[model samples]
Each structure stands twice: as C-alpha cells, then as structure tokens.
Target chain A: MGRKRTRPDNIRLTEVAELAGVSPITASRFFRNPEALSIGKRVRVESAAKELGYVPNLAARALASQRTEVIGVLIPSFTNNVFSDLLRGIYDAFESSRYSIQLANTRYSILEEEKLLRLFLAQKPAGLIVTGIDQTPESRIIMQSVDCPIVQIMEIGPDPVDMIIGFSHADAAQAAITHLLAQGYRRIGFLGARMDPRVQRRLAGYQAAMKAASLFDSRLMVTTPLPTSVTLGGTLFADLLAKAPDTDAVFCANDDLALGVLFECQRRHIAIPKQMAIVGFNDLEFMASAVPTLTSVRTNRYEMGRNAATMVIETIEGRRPEQPIVDLGFTVIERQSSVREP
Target chain B: MGRKRTRPDNIRLTEVAELAGVSPITASRFFRNPEALSIGKRVRVESAAKELGYVPNLAARALASQRTEVIGVLIPSFTNNVFSDLLRGIYDAFESSRYSIQLANTRYSILEEEKLLRLFLAQKPAGLIVTGIDQTPESRIIMQSVDCPIVQIMEIGPDPVDMIIGFSHADAAQAAITHLLAQGYRRIGFLGARMDPRVQRRLAGYQAAMKAASLFDSRLMVTTPLPTSVTLGGTLFADLLAKAPDTDAVFCANDDLALGVLFECQRRHIAIPKQMAIVGFNDLEFMASAVPTLTSVRTNRYEMGRNAATMVIETIEGRRPEQPIVDLGFTVIERQSSVREP
Candidate 1:
C-alpha cells in the first residue's frame, strides 16, 4: 500500500488577493458579495480565485458575522411529485439570493427525522424549513438548539417551532368528505396510504366530518394497507365491494391513489358520479386531464414552498416577517368525478 | 417607530475552547475528528461547545483544511424516478462517509446548468457529480477551474473531464431493438419522449439497428417532445396507430411512455403481443407489476450512483481510483409485453 498522504496546504485568501491584484479585504468582499463589486473586478477576482482553487473560510465568517448563507430543508420524501414541486418553489425563491439549500429526507419515518435533525444541526445553516411538526424528542432538542429562524411547511402544527406555512389537512379532507356527502354518497369508504402522520391527520379529519354529519356507520369506513399504486387501488376497490357492496362513494388519500381507484372502477363497469362518486386530495396537473376529470382538494404546494423560503430568508437577514403563521389555504375543485346528473 | 436594535455579538470558538480548558487548535481538531481524540477530553470539549452555542465554523475549517466534506450534484429533473433512484444510491454510499449533498435541477436547460454551476463552485464542495456530459461552454470553464474530482453520470461521453460512470445509451437501445427483431417484430415503430440528447442517441441507435437489419422503412420511426407523461404516451400511440395502422411493435423512450401506449391498447380493445408488442427503456419497479408485465431495458441506476459517489469520495481523500470509466452495463428484460406464442 502507498504511504499515508500528508494533508494539502491550505490556499489562503491573501494569496488569492495578490494573484487578483486586490487587497485581502477586497477578496473577502468578493466572497461575501460578488455582485457589489464591478463586473471587471468580479471577473478578475473570480478568475484568480478559480485559478487558486480557493474556498472561502465559512467557519471564520460564521464566528465573526453569525451567517452561513445556507438553508436547511427537511422534506418527507423525494419520490413524490408534491414534495418535488415544493422544492422547486423553494429553489426558485433562493436562486437570485445565492443561498444554497441542504436537503434531508425523513423517509416517512419519525425516527429518521430525529437523526436528520442532529445531522443538520451540526452544519449550522442560516435557517431551517421543515415539513410539518410531527418530530421526535431528539428532533425537538435539535430544533430548540437552532438559534436561527425556522419555518414549518405542508401542514400547520398545533404549536409551531417558529413560523408556519401550509394549508390545513383537516380542512382539505373535510372539504372532500362534504363534497361526497352533497352528492348523496351515504355509504362512502375512505382509502389512504400507510403510516404518514399527515395522511393519518386527513383520515381523522374525514372521520370527524362524517361523524359530525351523523353518517359514521360500520359500512362506510374501510381501511386497508395498500401500496400507493393504481393497481393496488383497483385491488382495494374489489375488496371494498366484497365487504360493503352498497358503497356509493370513495374518498382517496391523494390523486395517485385516486387514479388507481378510478382505473379499477372503470374496469368493473362502475359509472363514476352516477353509480359511485370519487374525490381525491392534491389537485395534481394530471387530475384535469384524467378521464372524467378527478375532483380533488387543491393544496398550493408551490406557494407553500415559496412562502416558507421567503420567510426563512427574511428571518436570516434579521428582519421580522409580517406573518409568521401563513395559511395559504386550499380549494375544492369540482370536476366530472363527483358531479352527478340531476 | 422602534429604535434600530443592534445584533448580538456572535460567540466564538476561542470562548468555547477557553471554557473547555483546551486550546482553540484542540477544539478545532475535536470538531473535525472527534473519535480520534481521547474520550474524556472529547466529552469535556463537546459539553463546552454545546454550552457556548458553538457552531463549528465550517468556512474557517474549509479555509484551513481545504476540505468542505460536501458534494455538489446537478440533475435535469427529480420528477423522473430513474434519477431519483440514482440519487438514493448516491445518498446510501455517502451516508456513512459523513458527506452532505447539495442538489440543483437544471430543468434540462443549458443556461440554467451554467448558472447553477457558478453557484455550486462558490460553495467549494469536495467533489462534483453531474447527470450528463453535455454541458455549456461557461459550465465547461467553471468545471475545468475546479481542482477537485468531477464525475459525470447516467450517460457515457466520448471524452470524460475527470471520471465517467454510466451505461452506453446507444448500445442499450440497440440491444432493445435487436431483441424485438429476434422476437420476429417486423414493421416496428419507435415512440420516444422529447428529443433530449441522450434519448436522441437511443433513437439513433435504434435507427442504425433497423437499417442494418434492412428494416429502415419510413413508417418505422416516430419522435415527439419529451417530459412525456403516461397520458401523453397513450395519446401518441393512438396518433401513431392512425398513421401506421399495420405497425406490429412499438419501442418507447421509458416505461412511463410505454405504460401509456399499453393503456391505450387496452382502451382500444387491441390485443397485446399478438396485435402490437411493446418495449420500454428503464425497467422501473412498476413495469414488473404492470398488467401484462412490460418488456424493458434495465440500466443499473443505483449502481451508477454508488460508483460515482465512491469515486468522488476516494478521489477527495487523495486515493488513486482504480477506474475512471465505469460502465455498469444494461440488460434487456423480456416480460409479457413483447412475448409471442409460436
């Protein structure tokens, strides 16, 4: 084996400044605010810095200025479109600000969230933007330790860690249930994904709306552990028909699950909004183009991301944002899936 | 109006070191390599660091040691599952290495890639992982200036800047086409997503294979814009059928597009394999579970990610990597979609 290699000597700012024909302070200013310098100076400094392979001393800056210009983003999953859309919005908001984002995925596990929190805390980003507030003890400790601003997104928490920016899952679910109820869907069934706290909250909200309307019966609620796939939705529908043959409506967890459920209904010769009504959450772009146009609760995922990013950036700059608790709100999109003929 | 308030002075590492009864150098080493130091001293230093709200200065450490322990990843889109799976593999490899990832989506735009490249360079990450090799002139300039290792993923280029870890898209496409021909699929038509350079290479390979086999008829190839959803795939199939009514087989750019074509066949009461055999690229998980399981080209997406991450990490540590060009290989998976009875 080769002998252990020695550490490379650090490339200093002073050397870079000398190469760029500028003072050390000017070199520091280039790293802090490259745009503040003239175009010619910016080009010269960047060229010299690149030639020297210079990396700014972020730790020293953090100690002296208390700013890292890095944002921490905690997301549920990268596999889904909703979260991806939200991330795109956050990215757009910070594009011009030169603020880099650090992402951590919870993978739908509360335990994983705690681990990610500790990891994120070690980095000491300028601010934090998390999805919801169903955090573990260790996660809470990490969040409490963060002196920077925090913004909770996707769903409102009972008590926010700092700022809150999201639509109410309960309200969105209630809207879907009420739509089914209005269409004379008495024996309605609820289909959902497995183990997400937010989805569970939606299920609870759906049940509450049904109970408040005095329509909570044994035949109406059917829960199953199905993977979020269209085929699973099809299989679940078949099982639902076997259990409760008279079920006239179904409320799905989200659009992907709903699409699967719809495909099954179509295969079984079930006329939607005629024999059975279907309602979904998250009015994804495909919902409108879907056959029979799916009726869904439209949560503004992109706006939620934009608002959360904006709040975090503002708080990082030592500005108190006007609204710490931002409820972007949701809308019930009426489509062919739930509209019945008079 | 309230008087302008002054910000609190940031706490320094010197203060934490003083409180812990250790030198600032020892404290810095503790933050960089905690496990290497004595446990008794580690506990005392960690406690003091925590008590003093000491955020280990990352910028300072970067300046001093020339290692940021961060990796920059650039992808075209996260909405695609193939890219996401690749990312999962990369994350798995780096999880234990304690390297954080900063991701940016170029949205398949060269201009966006150039801009994002500049932003990534400013962070001074240990290594860079880019999705494809087709970069802009400005991006090329910035990439060359970085002294650290860079790995290009997903597609192979004629010449690599530093490292290339991916499969040959052209070869994979040719294999798919030859497999179709071997299965006696003549009058085969190609249905592809938008003209991404990589996808175009696959199309070109298909065209070459067709011509070599003396089957290069005008009616055998079809091309459309990409970012194609399953719905679009379905519509495109219908349009293709209207034009080439005698077409016996269709090769799609990806599984999503193939699924759409398959769905359209089901809708039109057209028989699969017997009427129109279908082949897809990227053997996604859903393809295996799909109703008449899809025939597809399986690229080692996860392995691609793992290899790229490992190479970057090892290169950063000054280890001479064994291979700079890694082709994990691809396979043609034959399922019900393209199978025909004798």
Candidate 2:
C-alpha cells in the first residue's frame, strides 16, 4: 500500500456550520455560549462539530473573551490522602459545572509555594484555590494583585483574601483533646508531622484545650517536620514513649502517622486503649480497615473539594456565594483505638 | 474605632509600567517571556511589577500565545495509593517546568471518561495524560481531534493515539503467574476486582500463561465486582475456596485484596505457603509491612507519573521524546506470602 495517506487538514468553522445548516457566526456563538442558543440549534451544532472532529481554538477564544474557564489549585502534596481526596472532590464538582482544575504542589515549603504562586498567577487562572491562609509576603502580594476569586482551604484564619472554605483546625484539635480528657486520660501526648500553619492551628488548639483542663504541663507534644511517613510515625512513637513513659493517650497529626504509632504499639505488645489510647485526624479509608479500627477526626474532605470548586465557579460567573466562609464540619469517630470501656 | 477598610483594588499593568518608566507593551512583554529579554531590564520590570503588585491576565496571554501551558490528567481514583503516588511524581516533575496539571477521575467508567475527555478538550490543555487505553467511541473521537500531545498512562495498549506511557498489565500478569508456576504451584487461581478493560488485560494474560503451561480448563479464575477492601477480599477468598477447593495458589488484582485473603486464611487456621500461597500486584506501602510480607509485582507507579509528565512537557515544547512508548520495567518482589521452598 502506498504511504498511508494523510488526512486532510483545514476543516474550518464555515464547513461545520454549512454541514449543520447554520451560519458560521451561529457556530462560533454556539461554542462561546451554547446555553444562549435554542436546544435544537445547540444539538445540531454539537453534532456537526462532533462529525467534523472540531476543537475550537481556545487561544483565540481566550484572547477575545479574556476567560479561560480554568482554575489553579496549589496544595502541599498529592501523596497525602487528605489532599488527594479533596482534589478528587474538587475535580468531580468542577466536572459537573464544566470547569477544569490545574494543580501545583509545594511539598509544604513556603518558599516553594511562593514560586508556584507566581507561576500560577502568570498563567491567569479564573480563580485560585490554595491549601491554607499562611503565605509569603511576595505570594500574598501576587494573590492580592490578581483580579480573580481566591479560596483558602483545609484551615481557617482571620481576614481571608477573598473566600475561605475550611474548618477551624484549632477547634477540631480542642475537641479531640476534650474527648480524651473526659475519658479520664490525664497522661496525654501530641504527635504531629510538619509545622505548616494548618498543623500549627491544630497544635495550638490542642495546647489551649490542655491548658484549659489544667493538663498543659502534664501533656507531652512532639513536633516533627512536615510530611511524615508511616515508618516515621512508628519511630516517633518509640521516641515519645522513651521520654514520656506515663503517656496514656496520644493525638496524632493525621491517620497515617496514627496508624504507624498503632503498629509500633502492637509490635511492643502494648494494649491499645488499655495501656494507651490514640486519636488521629483525617479519618482516611485505612483507618476504618485497620485491625482495631483507628479512632480519628473525619473531615469532610470531599465536601471541602466540592465547596471550593462551587465557590470558584460562582465567583467566575460573577455570582457571589451567599456564605464566603463555608465550614463543612468534622466528626470525631470513636473506634476501638480510643474506646476505653464497653 | 472606624471600620477597617478593605485593601484598595489591585494595581494594573499600566500602573506598573508607568511607575517603572516603560510602556505597557514593554512591561507586558517582559512578564510574558522573561528569558528573551535582557536580564537587567527583566529584573527592573519584575521589581516594578512586584512593587505595584501587577499580575498578568493569563486568559488574555493564553489567547494570544495559543498555548495554555496546562496538562489535563484523567485518573481512575486518587484514594488508591498507587494512583496517588503516581500523581505525586507527575506533580513533582511538572512543578518547575511552567506547566500545570488539571485532573479528572473517570470512576472506572468508560462513559464518564468520554464526558471528561470532551470537557478537557473544551479547556484546550497543552497535553493530555489519561489512565488507560480503553476509551469510548466518543472519547476516541475527542482524543483524535485534539491537536496537542496525548499520553495514555497506567496500562499500555497495542496502538497508542499519540504516545503511550505505562507498564504492560498483561506482561505484569504473565510474570506473576510465571513466578508462581516456577515455585511448583500447579493448582493456581486468579482473584480480581470488577472486570475493567485493564483488569481484563491482566486476566487474559493470566489465562494465556496458564494455557501455555498446559493448565487450560483449570476452573481457577475467580472474579468479583466488589472493591478491593479487606472485608471484601476476605469474602472473595471464602467464595474462591468454596468453588475451587483444590486450588493451591492464588494471584490477586492488588495487594489490598491479597491482604484480605491473607487475613481470612489466618483466621481459618490455614497455614500460609504450607497450605496455600498467594501473590499480589502493585506492591502498596502496606504490603511489605503486612504480617507476612506480601509477594507482589513492583510497578514503578511514581516513575510512571514522572515519565508521563516529562513526555507531555516535551511534546508541548515541540521536542520529540526519545521514545513515545515507555515501558518502565516491573520486578517481582518475593516475600513470605508466596515463598514455599525450605
């Protein structure tokens, strides 16, 4: 066979419109805003476009309308299930609303986050969704300069740049601590990974609760760098036990770390909720499946994503969301890991 | 005290250029492509832009440049550590390359994938990174219509649209079966989740290997529609035993299911390796840490993401990648779960 013949190019809007019995202007308008046309006409244009294998030149559209229908999402890491789940939720919500999400991860570094933020701004997303409120001066300035909706997720802070959709990390921490205190676990400890502002909020909340219950000095708090793995969690627990021998309960930064601590305790033959109790944040899937079922705080990770996407879409459409600060609450799931009695 | 006023509206590009003693055109050019201009002039424009907090309108720039510099990623699920790790690698590789990733999940549905593909096309990403080769007719049309680079990941196919970047699922399956067969396990069985195209590829591969070894009509293939949860895995194993009473070894779709099977076997007092041997795929984090370290196929999931990202970026830059079809090799990690030799 002769060299596989190449398909002809230059299939234009005029040809598609002609085939569909509509004007080129109508076809252009159909792509720009299909909702504006009648259903019959819209269907016809879509079919014609599909038949012709049409891909509208988005660059031309962007230049004409100055809207790309894309949003920038910057987070610390994707390996963290919490963030990944949140991203999934956002993707789902955006998909339904016909928006696309662009992602950047800073790996939990402010300097890196600053660089990513500048890059994101240069790309000109219709909106921006960042992990938390804390940002570098340069990043903050760039965010302020961008004329797009801003959303800070996973943590709450005073005076958000524009919109904030997250829970009070401090409040969740305090509630976790209070639950432990009420259970009569006086010897408590806090095991955390990373000192990102969000984690710090949880730590502050934990401290406030301990001090309020007159157990501040009695409790031990261990803070490590951000993004701790399960192995690190196991090692951190061993380290904590060596220093605080009497610790009867522990609050971990998140479930992965908590699971690690639990595994370590099991290895040491320590009876859980008998010799010690444990609680974790971000009640991920493994938490429920773990041998004893890990006790943890369940944040609405999916809802966080959905709400953030909704807020961004609404902002892009010039429809201000009624509530800028949408707090999808967290629940403390009491599993065998933290239950002291029947 | 008087109510604290919100910060004034952000400074525009004109204001920054005027303050920096340059035309708006020069300032815009400096921001659009900094590398092309003189370093001193670029620095001055950037400093002035920083001082004025001028953020470029990305939508407009994208329109003029005909490149969004964003990659669209379509994944199956983020909750799975394999996919999450892969995404993390992709995100890391793309971090400094001036390209962002837009993610969508198909929920393992071909129809949903088609919808997502159409949505991705509307946004006009610079490149596309999708999970598998399986595509609905409409999705295939959209993929073919797109004028940019397209990379199909996770599972390889015989024919790729533009580029294919992932391990061969069929090869991985055959390798696992071959390893078990070598260990003198003749009465082997295969256990898997819902039959997706990728899973089908593995199943076909397993069957081919079994037939090649003269084990056709063995009645040892067990399939389930349930997710690879621990409880589900246990139930699946129980069912498998009831149906194939003489089966000596089983290969699971993933480690999660394998772990479940292991848990059930333990509970039933069936001696591992002595009574039954098992092999799993994906080599998730918990596999190595399980009570009996799991025997699994170590697919470089993270590297898959990194490679896919690299290919997309290269395609966007008009650079031909060294190879369009990259088969990052897989290895069999022999652990206690399948080791039977004394």
Candidate 3:
C-alpha cells in the first residue's frame, strides 16, 4: 500500500477495491459487514482504505436507509456520581454493538429535556434511553408519537411511554426511614439538596413514613434548590441542627450528603448511633469505606443502565420484552453509622 | 395544530412550507438556522412541522455539507469524578451551540481509542475533543490527517495534532512532594491506582522529588492497575503500610485515594499529620468537608474542558487561538491533612 493523501470526500469504495485487487461488492461488504468477508479480503480492503483515506459516506448510507445507527441518551447532570454509574452501564452494554451513543445533558431542566427530545427525534435515532419519567407535557407528547424503542430509567412509574426500568424512589426512601425507626431512633431529620423531581419523591416517602409513626415534624426537614455537593451536605446538616437541635437521626437525600453529615458529626464530637444516627441514599463506593461505614439505600443504577440499553437494542431488533416495565428494586445496607447499641 | 399520525418518512419539507404558507426556503431556514428567520415565519414553520409530524433530513444536509454539527468527545471512564468535572465544562460550553455531543468511552485502552478515532473520522465531525495526549501512533496519524480542528485535553506535551490544553502531571506531583517535605516529613510514600499515563507521570514526579532529596525508597510505593476507588485507596494504603510501616507521609494520585487513606488512618487511630500526613490530587469537594480537610493538587479540569472546547469551536469558525498550546497549570492547596502542627 502507498502512503497517499487522498481527499476524504474523493476516495470512493470502488477505488479502494481496485487498489486491493478485489471486487467492488467485496470491498463494500468489508465496510458494512466485515464478518461476511474472508480474513484475507478484509485485511486487504482495510489496508487499501487506510492508504487512500477512504472515509465511508455514513451520511449517504443513513439517508438511503432513512435511519442512523445512533442511540440518543438524555441525562440530567454529568457531574453527579449517580448518573455516572448508570452511564457506565449503558456504555458497557453497547461496547460491541453497532449503534453509537449521542448524549445530551438536560441540566435537570424539563424545558431543556423537551428541546433535546425534539432534536433527537429529528435525527430518527435507532432507539433512546431517557433518564426519568418526569418529562414535560410537550416532551411526553413527542415521545409518545415518535416511532422508536424508548427506555425510561432511574425511577419506575405508571404510564410509561414505552419500556421502563427503575426502582421506586419513594419506596427506597421509606425503607431507609423504616430501618432508622426500627433502630429505636425518632426525631429523625431530613437533609436534602438539588430538589429534583426524584428527590422530591424521596422527601414525600420520608414524610409518609414519619407520619405513619406519629413522629413527623415540619421543622425536621431542611432542603435546598442548589446543586448537591459534600460542602452543601455539611451546610444542610448544620441548618437542620439549628432548626431541630434534638434530632436523633438524619436521612440524607444521597451519599454525598450522608458523608458530609458523618464528617460534621465527627467535627462536633457527636457519637454515631448514640448521640446521632445517619442514613443515606445511593450506596456509593465511599460509603462502605468511610471511617464509620455508612448505612445507605443501594439502588441498582448500573444494572438499570445496562438493562435499559439492552432492552432498547432488543426492542429495535424485534424482540419485545415480556415485561415492558421492570423494577430492579433497592437494598438497605445496614452499617455502623445507623446501627444502634442494644 | 392537528394530532395527525403522519408517517415520519412521508412528511416532506415542501408540505410543511405549504401548510405554513411560507416558501420552501423559509421552512428550510427555520430548521437549519431559526435565528435567520423572523419570529412570525419561524413559529409558523415550527407549528406546521409539528402538526405534519415532519422530520428534517439531517443525513442529506450532512452529506451536502460534508460535515456534521457534532463534536465527538473521547474520555477514559464515566465513573471517575475527575472526568465528570471536565465533561460538565464541555457540555456547558456547547449548551447553546448548534453542535451536539457524540461521546465514546475508551475504557483507558489506546487500541480502543484508535478504533473510536477511525469511527469518528468517518462521521466527518465539526470538531473533536479527546482526553489526554496518549493516543496510539495509528490514532495520532489519523487525527493529524483529519480536516477538522482537534483539541487534546488533560495533559500537555510537545507536538500539536491541531491544538492542546492541559497541565503537567509531573510538575504538579513534584510540587505536592515539595510541600510535604517543607512540612518536615522525610518518609513520603506514593499511592496510586488506575495507572493511566497521567498517573504514571504523577508517580514519576514523586520519584524525582524523593530522589532529589536522597529519600527515595522502592518500598515506599504502591501502585495498581485496577480502577481507582475509595475502597481501593484503603486497600493500597494498607498494603503500603505493610511494606513500609515507617512511612510518614503519602501523596495519592487522586482525591478518592486520599479520602480512603484518611478513613483507614481514622480506623487505625493514626492521627493525621501528627502520625501520617496525606496529599491528594484533583481536590474533590469531599476533601474539604472531611473531618480534617485534606490537602490536594488543584488542577483546572473544568477550565481545561471549557477552554479546549471553546478553542476547537473557534478554530472551526476560522478564528485560530492566540496560542495553540495552553498550559492551565495546577496549585497545591495546603490543608489540615498534610500540615504538621508547628
């Protein structure tokens, strides 16, 4: 093969085939389905293509088929560790697949998500994996009308647009509160940040569980609209103590807040479980490795992502899932931070 | 607007224009550049398109232009907090732009990165932003030959594939050790995981710093190829202790490891800075909220990403950056974790 600097647009598959001393159809097959070609012919076509700088006209191919091998994914935030695990699962499941991922960040705004939905639909994506069931009315209408496989992830709810998979956020939050109550701790305070829809559902569950036990106190709740971070976690916990100093336990919206609460307890000489107890959502890796291993609600985020992608791909391939809605469920991991001394 | 179930492939641009009572060129302009159309025409075309369930033929447009309004991003891992900050910058920079992001995870494999490079080049992206400067030779050749502007982020080095922006990992690591040395700590060890090229540079800096002071010891190092995590940080610190129990200070490759080492020290009753000083890289938010705030190297990850993206976009728009090579640099944030009581 010669080192030729052919213009990307000018190098055709036929020229590559001629240079490789193969039929044009064989070279074309090498580009579309290399597995169908023998190894010798595959190598020859690839070398010739590389030498000639033959870039496949993906646009022309997509135009002919009226579809592109692309899966559009919409998520709220890129910095949040929760979504990171989910994204990893999605990427892992599609590693060997033909579909390329087109990711859009909604920035936790319903309007932004709606705009992105319109854009993706315009591209005629092979499939889609949306973050949650909390899209705006316009987004919902567009998604319902579109003809593509869709997977709603991060929370399970009624009236899914297509396939859906995720545990109930409210259910998980109530379970965490129940575990704390079982440990003989009342006067439980809730610390939250980034009050997104899913988090609001968690707060609702906390309220429901507390009300059931006749331990609900309006002053026990402290939340913020600001984005969540360890710093914010500590700030919210401090605010909670200022409002309800007699609080015996705290349930954080997520693990970052839980770790912050733990650090605050350590800073103030507060004893774990004795003077104060803490429970967190999303059993992030650091929770188990903290000084006092933290108790947390472990959601199957990775599994949710992997399964959602698999479902979308399978649906696109004409294999409809037996159950359109799947609840991966959650686990309450008991640890040193919340276990009381009998 | 009618809720007609018009087939996506059947609705043409001309029909949308006819319904809106506008010329076909005006309808086309509404899709390609809404800002170029007046508010009256834009709204009319949009509503008509929605009513008719019209989808823009982006593939045909891409073919005509020989480019896509897509900026391909290649990163190593999704779960790493370091890259999360970087990705947020990239996404934020392009929030209002015409280009959409096509993201691919390389899983830290050079060969995988090369494969992704070929795939992305085939799409004729408007621009590209790649993580790190450690692309395989084949990938480098492909990148160099590509027509679009490119930015190599994460770390800086000689030679420009197009443009580059990042800091020196070795210099940052050396500065971290110098600070530890100034604190009167002689036996400084290193803890690292996910020994990617950048981490290897940090290890090299640690070695250089120790050797300069005649305190280098092969026993004072623990590195792992396994992915980095808070749990792995504790495991590696435990192993380091077993190998060099007399070690007085440690420089972690990232904040996760530093946080883990802090927890392990607390578990073992080792007074931080009093018994073992700690330094971490990236200075994640948790580092500040830890009981004893941890010291860390503050790299401009967000700035790196935002600026890299801005540079690529500007280059594509025919406005070359004032400087082709950018070094954002790093700062050694002194905190309680590594500061010895005077």
Return the top candidate by TM-score.
3
Candidate 3 residue A198 C-alpha distance from true site, Å = 1.1
lDDT of 3 by residue, A1-342 (tens): 754654555677789999999998899889778999999999999999989988767788788667898999999999899999999999999888888888989989999999889889888899999988899999999999988999999999999999899999999999999999999999999988999999999999999999999999999999999999988888998999999999999999999999999999999999997899999999999999987899999999999999999999899888989999999999999999999877
Q: For model 2, how does the per-residue alpha-carbon lDDT over A1-342 read when each residue is reduced to its tens digit?
A: 554545336356888899888999899999868898899889998999989888766566654554566688888887777887898788878876645677777888889889878766665568889988888888888888889999999876677888998899899988898888888898789888877787888999999999898888633888788467776677778878988999999999888778778778866889888899999998876677666677899899889988898888888888989888888778998888788785
Model 1 residue B125 distance off true place after TM-score fit, in angstroms: 1.9
Query: Tens digit of lDDT per residue, candidate 1, span B49-95?
Result: 88977765566666566467789999888677788778878887887
**Per-residue lDDT over A18-99 for candidate 1, one digit per residue giving the tens place of the 0 to 100 score:** 9999898888899877888888878988999999888765556764664577898888776667887798889889877857
lDDT of each candidate versus the true structure = 0.81, 0.81, 0.92
DockQ (Cα-based) for each candidate: 0.31, 0.34, 0.69
Model 2 TM-score relative to the real fold: 0.82
Q: Which candidate, 1 or 3, would have the higher DockQ against the true structure?
A: 3
Tell me the tens digit of each residue's lDDT in model 3 across B60-174.
8897667898899999999899899999999889877777788899999999999998888888899999988889899999999988999999999998788999999999999
For model 1, the superposed segments whose C-alpha errors exceed 4 Å read A1-60, A137-147, A218-227, A263-276, A289-293, A317-321, A334-337, A340-342, B1-55, B137-145, B218-220, B266-269, B289-293, B318-321
- How high is the DockQ of candidate 2? 0.34
Calculate the i-RMS of every candidate, to one decimal place.
3.6, 3.1, 1.4
- On DockQ, the leading prediction is 3
Please report how far candidate 3 places residue B119 from its true position, in Å: 1.0
lDDT for position A78 in model 3: 92
Instruction: Point out where model 3 deviates above 4 Å.
Output: A1-56, B1-56
